[model samples]
Target: MKDIIILMFRLMVCIFEIWMLFGFYNNFLKNKPRKSRNNIFIILVFALIIFAINSIDNTILNLICVPVVYFVLAIVAFNGNVFKKLFGTLIGTIVILGTELIIVAVLNITSKELIESSMVNEPSAFVLTIIVKMVTFIVFEIIKQFSSKESEMMDGKTFCLYILTPLSCLGIMFSVVFCRIDFTENSLAKSVLIIFFFCMLIGNAAIFYGYNRYAKILVEKEKNRRTVMEQKMELESYKKVNVANDRYITLLHDTNHHIKTVYSLLKKDKKDDAMNMLSKLFDKYEKAEMIEYSGNTILNTILSDYKEKSSKENIECDIFVERGFNIEYVDEIDLVAMLSNLLSNSYEAAAKSDMKKIRIQMFMQNDGSFSVIKIENSYTSMIVEEDSVLKTTKQNKEFHGLGIKSVQQIAEKYNGWLSSTWSDNVFKSVLILENSMC
Candidate 1:
């Protein structure tokens, strides 16, 4: 019974170690469910099962027990596909066993006599074995977290600390297992002091290495982030310039028509004709003035520019915009990109159809939380695809399905939802996004 209890305790330790390792991998190394309560329940259940089965004494049974523990851990960690879970767990088990062997070999070569002497007492030997198991677990976990394919920038300082601190603890354990120390005179005291000193050395070395590696990565990430910010700013400026230039060029071209109309009216020598011409000219000027929605200047410019293009293409564009809000929400450039891409795609599609017409509707929610956008356009050909992605026609090589992808990406970045459908020769795109201010 006593042996059984001891075995249960050891099994409990192994199960707990597995939970910690798997939890770390699931939480930090890969994307997983975020609810804390669900995670706790999963860990607890896995720990219980592994603890129950890991108590077997036979060598073959013990070997079988390892895979069982790993299998349970994989189930908890994966929570979905069995194949993926099995593959990951198998890989993890191999790595852990390999590391344990390496550490054991190093300890045997460096402190063979010390280890043998330490095992004289059953309690001391159990403690030493537990420590060895823990160190092996830590080393393997550290390797797994750091070596994954995920971008390091996404792993914050807390995760980095989790990996580094455990690795340092394992390194200290390695030194403790190997270092020679005279413990006969003051056994407990000498052992404590030696372990403390070994920890200090290992801790320092781990910190030094971790800092060197992570610091460089951090610096490079900062530089890359800065570069991205600069490029976004430049692109915004360029977009604004292009919109302004287009507006200016349209105004200049209209001036010639205005002059010719005025000259022709004056030559007719009728006061009423000149007054009518002047009234029409003022109406044209009023129509040229851009429409503003939600205080987003970029979007206003894009709407105005696209309206003019639609008129020129003989495409009937019907726009319905909600009242402008006082609050500053979504970045103007992003808004422009989103709207322009959607409208431009619609326009292009409409141009190919016999019935060239586009409908645009936009409105802000009463709660000031989100904005909704819907656009529909007439199209010539069927837009259905097996993959749910709309592909470009063969005739249009320069511009393809990239516009839709851009819209989708921008929506995703803002935690937005986008959907599209096509039927009865009409293509529709819809998007809903949280207001940036909220």
Candidate 2:
């Protein structure tokens, strides 16, 4: 009966651990967390296998089977490249093994004392495991609910902490197990194990505290930057509106002056000169005083600023945008930086080109699902391509291409990407941002 209770307790712990391990990933992904309908079925099936293993357990066999449970849970729950899933399982297994070592070592010390006092039984050990697993489940639930889910997966090296910390715990366990040559005397070995456990706890606490604090600081900085950019965009938007109003008041006078000049040239029968004057007027007067670009005032502000800048630099910028599009969900700073870099590059290239023109195309489509921007420009000098990348002509190659890289990073934040190509002496960049409508 005691053995049966032990198996049931093991089954319960295994089920709880499975839930804790697999459910952890959902907290870190960008999408809303979802529980698979088949998750319960999978857990129950594995719990039976765990119970069977516990009933006829050999230490070696149990060690092997335990990791199988975690691996299965990871494979079922994780959505990623094979390496991510495999390494994720490896981290989970290392933590579990390290934790089990501490549990077993503590259990041995306590069980020996209880045995001496005639209070020890198989059921007592099972009860101890139940208490431990229950406490662990609570901890996992608290961490999952309270801790901030990662905005994105940690870089491979940072995630290695999940491996290194547990491996350190395992190393300490091995030192305690092998060096003393004594297993049971309530000796210095137990003290060492207890200290190692506390040390790991402190280490984990420090990591969590430091990492979360740093992440919070970064997020705050990003928000502040965006807030500043939003204000700047608003100010620019107001300036454009005011300047456009002024231009509206002067447009009639300017048209009257052009018409008088052209009419005089025609009266003199200088038809060619009249036509040249008319063409110049056409070039300068094409844009209306007030043109609606997009509903996103921030975007409109950027487009207007750069359009004026390009005109001043004698670069022709052709902009196209869809009506009634929404980009309120995007971070203003990121959007600004992306467009700023793109236009900066286009201006530089067009300044050096014979054509001296930049073609800009922006549109919203896919039922409010995406906003796309395409910029194409001509480069007169050799593109300086190496390894399929358009190398910068600036002497400081180190900093030359960072603008594009930064723009790419911004695009990635929106679940989109930036791609650039240089072909037939024409350089083009395409940025796609996923729109968040719902």
Candidate 3:
């Protein structure tokens, strides 16, 4: 009965720990549930069975089993590739086990006799273990939240002090409850080593802070570079649009002369010649410019640019945009960036595929509060993603995928959704955004 009780306590601990880990994950990564989950009930039953077996008290067996349990749960609970699920679960389990070891070290050094007595008394051990688990969980939660949101501008020296403070408190408790070390023999030496460890803890903090600062700087620089490149592309597109519209204006300016020539031919009793001349002029005018417009300048410009591009690439681009469609509240820069990216991706993929076709549809919501853009294109290349992170085929992995990522960020900023699907050798993506991203 006592063994059974211990096992039950351990099982409870496992459940709490799993729940807490996932809670932190959800908060940090903003994970959401998958739609159309038919196997959810089966997954829960498997989870129940995983947490059910704590009776096999062998360390080797338990170590092997814990990883398998979490790995399986990761597959059911997480949305990503198998490699991502297994890797995340494996690292998380190590962190948790490392924390447990830290707590054990503290307990053994501080309340050596109490822990020793607890080893013999199962109830006391269970209680002490529960207490330690809670403490460790809380500490980890604080660390994760802090690290994720830490400011790059934080002073390294002061920040390191802030982090190690809790660690120092934990160490101090161990020192005050000192029992394992022989006090008379080398108490002074042991005290110095404890101080040294505390100092080195700051070194650990420094490494984290330095890496964070470097990564933040690197990301900001990369984004700035991509933004410049995108803006330059936009400028070139606007130039082409301006040139096309100018040519159409020139054709209209010369229309009267062309019409007068046809009229003179008709007056000379050459009606067939006049009609043939008029038809030739009309052909030139149509060849010079063929256009479809949405009232929104940004949307119209990008669609026109891509339409011409599709023709050149021998890809049929079908665009169905609501007539007189206008966007008043969406940021012009953001709109341009998003549309440019979506169209560029479609054009690139469609140009490479055998089908050589791209389809785009955009419409305003009837309620006038939102809009949706849907794009589908042919894709022949395989996509490999890990943990929802897109892998690029380009030489510079850092530079590629910035377009889609920027669009995603824009969507998220507006509390909107960006969804993508690949089926039947076609890739379809949709962006739904609210008006006035205030």
Candidate 4:
């Protein structure tokens, strides 16, 4: 019964160690924390196979088993890049095995006879083994966490940490081996307790370091997001001011022409014709001023700006927009960025074509759950390549390639969707965004 218990304890310790190592590799090394359930099951099976191998005494079997397990783990880490995966797993396994050997050596030097005796069916000895393995696992996990964050830095701090952390673990193990402790009358339980406490101290230190680094990363990312938001707001304000100024200037200039036309008609004594012409011109001018919509001012400005540019290039522009869209679902800046990229691309494409025509349609659904925007233009050739990027032509290299990628990024940021296709010599792009207003 005592022998059975010892075997069971060893099995459990091995399984736990494997679990921690594989979990760390999957999370920190692969940078994929959210794997499927199938992957977890596969790792567990592999760990069990490794644990079972200790029962086998055949040297050939042990040699083959170790490499196979490491190979499987490497495949998981390197996403099936056999050479890199094998190399990394081999290095990691060597470090782990080396640390274990050092631990055994230290215990031997400190209390050779006592350690050998303690290994014989003592529950306390098994507990000490568990404590050591757990502590080592935690230390390695901490190193992995810190190393991941450090990798993002411009400097080589993370790389230095990675190199130093494993070395430090090795040094600690060696120190414990070299320092002899006279365990003359100390109970195995008491000795195990002391080692457990020391291991806990090391684990705690690692936890502190990992948390501090993780928190710093969070703070930096938050600051960057805020700065981006501020810049976007400033750009939107500038666009509004420019649009308002241009509208005012255009109105002032048109008023003088209106007055001159009225005066000439009256002098010709064609009073009825002059009144009719004045009424039509006044209605047309008023309609021009009524383009702005309150709910989505940024989108309105973008459309208006593109419309003016298209008119200058002699590209016929057709736009139909439904009023009173719910702006609650998207920030003004993101909305502006999305529309600006899409419309600018359309205008540029249309300008390059022989037909030179573009059509834009935007509307909010009746359910108020989504907003749809579509832009289509006549093109001399297909716009997108097989990879779904705008194909560049010698005449329009500057603006042809980036529009689709920009729109896709904006859509992803807002939890929206974008798709484009070409058919019948016409290019069409469609965007759908969840209406946060609902």
Predicted model with the maximum lDDT? 3
User: Between 3 and 4, whose TM-score is larger?
Assistant: 3
Model 3 residue pairs with clashes:
none
Q: What's the C-alpha lDDT at position 414 in model 4?
A: 64
- Writing each residue's lDDT as its tens digit, candidate 4 over 1-438 gives 757856766666666656556655544355344456856666667767877886776767876787678767656543534565666567557656655666566665676564555333354455346446644664665555555544233234544564455456545543443443334466654456545544554454465447546866976775465446546744965666576668668877887887788889899998998899889777666545535744555666667767767877999999887776566577766666677667767777789888898999877775878888989998875543654455655467553454556567668766788998877768899998877667
Residue 258 of model 4 has an lDDT of 79
| Clash number for each model | 0, 0, 0, 2
Off by over 4 Å in 3: 1-142, 145-195, 270-276, 288-290
lDDT, candidate 2, 124-205, per-residue tens: 3433443344334434434454444544334456656554654555455434333433325553454354444545644554
The global Cα lDDT (0 to 1) of model 2 is 0.65
- Cα TM-score per model: 0.46, 0.51, 0.59, 0.45
| Candidate 4 clashing pairs, residues 3+ apart or interchain | 106-177, 329-436
C-alpha displacement of 362 in model 4, angstroms? 1.3
Report the error of model 4 at residue 215, Å: 19
lDDT of 4 at 404: 59
What does candidate 4 score on TM?
0.45
* Deviation in Å, model 3, residue 295 alpha carbon: 0.8
Measured by TM-score, how close is model 1 to the native structure? Answer: 0.46
Task: List candidate 1 segments past 4 Å from native.
Answer: 1-12, 24-34, 76-81, 119-127, 130-138, 145-168, 182-438
